[model samples]
Target: MPPSESATRLPPGPDTAVTLGIDPETLETLTYLQREYGDMVGMTKPSGRLTYFINDPAEVRRILVRRHVRYQKGPGFERVKMLLGNGLIVSDGDAWRRSRTMIQPAFKVQNVHRLIGVMIGCSDRRAVAWAAAAERGDTVNITEETNEFALELILISIFGDDYENRFMKEGDNPFAFLSKDSTRDLSVVMKVRALRNLVLEIIEERRSRNEESLDFLSMYMRATDKNGEPFSDEELLDEVMTLVVAGFETSANTLNWVWYVISGHPDIEQSLIDEAGRWVPTVDAVTAENLTEMRYTQQVLEETLRLYPPVWLFTRRSIEEDELEQYDVPPGTDIYLSPYILHRSEHIWPNANDFDPDRFALVEGKPRKDRPYFPFSLGPRRCLGEYFSFLEMKVHLGLLLPRFRMQRVEDDDPGLELAINLRSKRDILLKPSVR
Candidate 1:
């Protein structure tokens, strides 16, 4: 049967004259399109290429799942490739499929649960320094704190004993530049080169030892492709760097926002503290089951992601002709979807601009999957770190919230930076006091 008449036409959308190499601008464009042209919008870029903005959840799912092969990682990926090489996040087709399968086992719930000791150890470091700062009545740079926390945790998780014995031997964290600098320019390139050298030296040392190590590096080193071939040195480096970048920034940003939100709403903050205290009574109580039972804490993190998703905007290319409910997407058409816009779309979320964790509670016969929500994205290529991230976040808040009251230092909101990852435009400052 022929497609519906509406599906034969592209919905009206913004002109390319508007984009400014910024994600928030792209999100603004998407919001305006959804308002002006409904859920499905279409337009022609300045280069005269067709594009579509798909907001329907089901269609979004179908495209990412059953039909993913028809497309490749599209526009805006060049910038990511500059940083990640051809890591899983940027690679497509067989390469992506192969890498994802080989690496999926390492992130299984059991494997992630094994990392809890590291989580506790890292949070204790934060607790010690934070307690000292609270005693001095000092305002804490929670932004930097979360960044360092996530960076250190991911390093320890990835390197195990070597994190303390090797990386710390320099007496300074070598991975500090990633959190301090925002620009992905020449300076960032040089810094990444240095990081690569460090990783390469470690990889070689591990190979020379000929002994088994049970960390992520060991797992990736042993992961072989379908041809029974290990990842090339280049591929291994890209994947490791990808993990370092992805594992830290998103979790850190979520925590930074979580602290801001918790500070503003004392009642909700108290609830989180109570829940954490009740469920996670001690370091011993921080098991996988205990972390999973921190339901309210999970809601808080979800709501925070809705407000500030790390990868706020995603761009893809429609490789084959496709028809949406109200738009005809042609082959080679560029497509832009914004989770930041969809999360705040009032038609789907009432009082969408407000912070409310109650919206996440599971109602009888109601499910959040039905909503237009995709903070970690949707479909097959969705983030591999989604479950791991939430787990780490729950552990962090669960361990810390019970003992400290976090107060926002600034009256004004920290606006969005909207780069590769969503970051606060200003440093988020908060004061921590023992409760």
Candidate 2:
């Protein structure tokens, strides 16, 4: 079949050339395309590659879950590759498969459960800081607080004792740049290279010790392929960097929004407080079982993610010809899917812009699985840290919300910064008072 015939079958989009890059404006561009061309829109990029912005639920699921093998991690990942190297998030084909398999065990529920004490400790550290701020009448920068909290948690989780004894002894955390600096320019690239060397030092020290440890670094070092071969030093560094970047940023961003959202809604805030008081009245009482019982907090986090998924935009390149619903995807086509756009689409979710946690509430007997919700994404490529992040967030809110009440320092919305990760354009500030 000729390309024209296939093109005709694809959904209609503007004939004029469109430039889509991974930036804030890409959201507006995609929204414009969806509004003008409907659910499945096709256009030609400046590179002359055919691109499709797919919103149809079944087609989205098909590409992400069913026919994932036919596609590879596509455009916009070059920037991520600079920082992550061949990590699981940016790598494709056999490389991704092997790394995912080797690292999967470290994220198992039991393994994550072992880190709950660390989660509580991290949250308590924040509590102490916030209490001092409360006494001093200082406004808490929730954005920075969450960033530091998550960074500390993931570092301790990954490096264990070395996080305190080894990594911190270097004076300032070298990995702090990942959160403080968002721009992916050449300077960020240089910093990433420098961080890799720091990680290599830690790996070398661990290798020389030759003792077993419970941290993720030790686990990854021990994890072997099906043939019983371990990851090369370079490969291990890539995976470590990927974990640090992936594990912390998403949870931090979500908690930052959660604090902002809860500050405004008193009824929701009170309900969450009540739940936390009942389930986790004290930090010492926090356990895996009670944390799971804080169901309302989970809904709040879910709704927050629906509004601001950290990885808001995703891209894939079709390696072979494939058929989508009512369209033929030719080979070498670039695919774009936006969880932020789809989660807020009015056609799929009524009153999609509203911050209603009840939309996720169980009805009749089951949760609303039919709704298009993929904050962490879907399929085998779905985030491995999903379980860990949830537990961490729950612990933070459960212990913290009960003890302290926060008021939004600024009444205006912080607005969105749709970069590689979806974040607030301005840092969210809140005034904290002891409850």
Model number with the top TM-score: 2
Query: lDDT per residue, candidate 1, 282-309, as tens digits?
Result: 8898898888788888888889999888
- Candidate 1 colliding pairs, count: 0
List runs of model 2 lying over 4 Å from the truth.
1-8
TM-score of each: 0.95, 0.97
In model 2, state the lDDT of residue 278.
89
Candidate 2 residue 239 Cα shift, in angstroms, is: 0.4
What TM-score quantifies how close candidate 1 is to the native fold? Answer: 0.95
- Off-target runs (Cα >4 Å) in candidate 1 are 1-8, 14-20, 364-367
Worst 10 residues of 1 by lDDT: 1-10
